[model samples]
Target chain A: MPIRRLLVANRGEIAVRVLRAARELGIQTVAVHSDADRESLAVKMADMVMPIGPPQAAKSYLNVDALMKAALDSGADAVHPGYGFLSENATFAEKVESAGLIFVGPTPEAIRIMGNKSLARETASKAGVPCVPGSDGVVDSVEQAVESATRIGWPIMIKASAGGGGRGIRVAHDADELRSQMTTAQAEAQAAFGDKSVYLERFIRRARHVEVQVLGDGKNAVHCFERECSLQRRRQKILEEAPSPALSADTRSRLCESAVQLARSVGYRGAGTLEYLYDDVSREFFFIEMNTRIQVEHPITEMITGIDLVREMIRIAGGEPLRFKQSDIVMRGAAIECRINAEDPDRNFMPSPGKVHEVILPGGPGVRVDSMLYPGYTVPPWYDSLLAKLVVHAEDRPTAIARMRRALRELHIEGVKTTRGLHLTLMDDPRFQAAEFDTNALEGWLAARAPAASPTTTTSP
Target chain B: MAHHEVLSPLPGTFYRRPSPDAEVFAKEGAIVKVGDVIGLVEVMKQFSEVQADAAGKIVRFLVENEDAVEPGQPLATIETA
Candidate 1:
């Protein structure tokens, strides 16, 4: 079905991203926001802005009923979850579909399969994708976790069976630590993901986090190479680069093939990311999980492949076939992305929320900044701290690094503390340049270069 | 006697206290001053303190604790005196 009017059931940068894509397709966009985001750039840019509820996401963005009502009231033919919030909520997807409004995502069943990590692991295993050795089902008790750890061996990772974004994960080296971490992990998992079910996996230390972007038309799927997102702190990716430096040509091809196989196994549709942990020393890659929605680091893939993923998602939702064949796809150059957040990385990444007095974005060749910020815009404390994503692409890794550094230096936002300085330092680090790091690299780097005592704290000017 | 307008600045679940069974920040018939913390509204993970911009006596409570509210949703009617 062709989507005429689309209601974006999200806010902030992603709302703007979806709105921009919809506008390009000549679709009217309806933006739903909390009371706090009445003046947000997304609301201002959208064709119509409706108040979903208050600032709380529960009453606003995640309120499936409110979103459906808004879509109905606005005469929107489709609803886009735009990542996070209820983006992966299967019930919400089904409700959207049942309400006669097309959901701009995968099938509700696909969302259900991927939302549960254990089920996804099983699905990947069935599809011949390598997965970490761990429990095949949910571990409901500490005893089960300990037994699983003993069987899978120590240094096991306890993760929420229905978790993502590093929320319900705990790594334990011994039985005692495993027991304690299991409780904490379960509690956090319940609070964050609304699921207390936990599972175990053999922890793969020093693993490079790589993921392939895939698009499917519910029948066939195509892979968009791989992106290295190892530079993360607290399990959140801070930087991402396409055409991972760690992957050999053979490994890259195999990884992409595996991702395609997995996508085909589920008859996946829309934009999805197949995440894997690649061990450099072992040269083995294991499937982690799949994100059944548009990813935050999609810009890097776009920079390298020159494919508008968002546009393609809309097309696929409209029942279009795969736009291009596998042979037609080509990765042109290395692309890097640095997530600029409104936080003081020097001070434990505490959120720095306030008004943006002055805003300056990077430019020049290969530089792309996706943001929803403007002067006098208030960085609301009610949402994610990401202010913008700075992406750059060049002929090679070194050139891409240089471009990213230049972009970081050129980027400026006054009246709010940002992680721009941290990105600059990371781009200049020798280890980062050599690509000899793992997911823990950022945390180690920060620990080694701890900000000076009494670091200067700035507020919105 | 003077008249004052009670307005909600943001939308969220309005709570009269930090938690259930806890004393509310303000009550009906209580004299309130400008800038007084009258209630709390949670949006996402952040909790915002809704302050009274006009001094008056809270004559009527318009919303119950933990009630879902929208921006400009009336919380309490205040009578300036």
Candidate 2:
């Protein structure tokens, strides 16, 4: 399909990102916003703005009918679901196609297959990709969980088959804990993913979270190398870097190749990320799940490979083949990205949404800030607190870390409390600098350094 | 002593009347009891009625038809009769 006018069925930084890319391609953009985000940056940047609904995400971003109506009403030829919200929703993808608007993503079948962790694992194993040792199907009872755990060995991880973002996952040390954790995991999974299907996997303690970016046009696929996203809190990636410092040349090659193989097997098209849990000690990587949308950490990959992933996705959606072959791809300098959020890390990462009184983005050699914030811009409280992404690229990991620390120090945002101070502290931590950390590193580091008393609380201007 | 505030339970586009030509459900000087349908808010193509939870007189209409409202945003000010 030749996408002329595009309706972005998302909001915040991603919406702004897509609008910019579409505008650069001479594609008219229609931005849909909830009542809370009527005056948001994305709405202001787009050619046309439509009100989807109110502040609640269920009534706005997740409303497939409303999104389709907006696309139809705005005369949009295609709908682009940026990451999060309804981006991975197979039903929404199918509905978009049925509504006659080109869904700028993978087919609904691909989404459905990848949306479920258990099914995805089966698919990966069939494709000869190493999958985490786990059950091949959903575990319905405690007995079933225990059986799977015994087969997979003790210290197994119970995960919601339909879950993501670290939710609906419970690590059990023994049988008793597994029994209790299984029920909790099931309840959480049902509440969060609307699917109570739970599965078991051998938990890799102190494992590094790494992922490879892949682009495909169903028949052809290419890998954009790997990103080390070990820095996480509550199962959400807080910081990510490309050209993972932890991987050797051979490991990196194998990881990328595995990701490409899986993408080709699924007939994957558009931009996707093949996530894996890497055990540094064993030097083994296992496929976790595939995110079938533009990722928040795509900038790091873009910096290292010089590929505009969003542009590639749009081109592929327009039925274009891979513009560059695997041989043409190159991974250069290391790139790091820190998510700047409208939150007070000192206060348990509580959101501090308000107006921006002053804004000064870091600008120096290898420093890049992707944001839509300007002085006097109000941060709405209804959506994710992420305000911007601070990205830096250098010839090596050490240089990239140093550059990120410098950029963070130079960057300043006022009128709301931000995680800037926390990011600065994290950058200065020796463990983080050495990249000798796991997914749990951030939480432990923060808990240890947390103030004896309530940390400095900043109010809105 | 009594206190009352008319509010919306869900987020949507606030509409003052059933239709453009119809009389508004509530207006200045109009008295309403608890559970009275004061207005309608359209969310995702579904129109949900916003009811008055207290017995009062409509003192002021804080929002007009087609106004985008958030959850708990006051749609009208109701003064206890």
lDDT of each: 0.87, 0.86
User: Which parts of model 2 have CA positions greater than 4 angstroms off?
Assistant: A179-193, A451-461, B1-81
Encode model 1's per-residue lDDT on A339-401: one tens digit a residue. Answer: 999877866666677889999999999999889999999887677789999999999999999
lDDT of 1 at A103: 93
Stretches of candidate 1 off by over 4 Å are: A139-148, A172-196, A451-461, B1-81
Local accuracy of candidate 2 as per-residue lDDT tens digits, A245-352: 899999999999999999999999999999999999999999999999999999999999999999889878877888989999999999999999876776666566
lDDT of 2: 0.86
- DockQ (Cα-based) for each candidate: 0.11, 0.04
Q: Pick the candidate with the highest lDDT.
A: 1
Compute each candidate's TM-score over C-alphas: 0.83, 0.83
* TM (chain A), candidate 1: 0.93
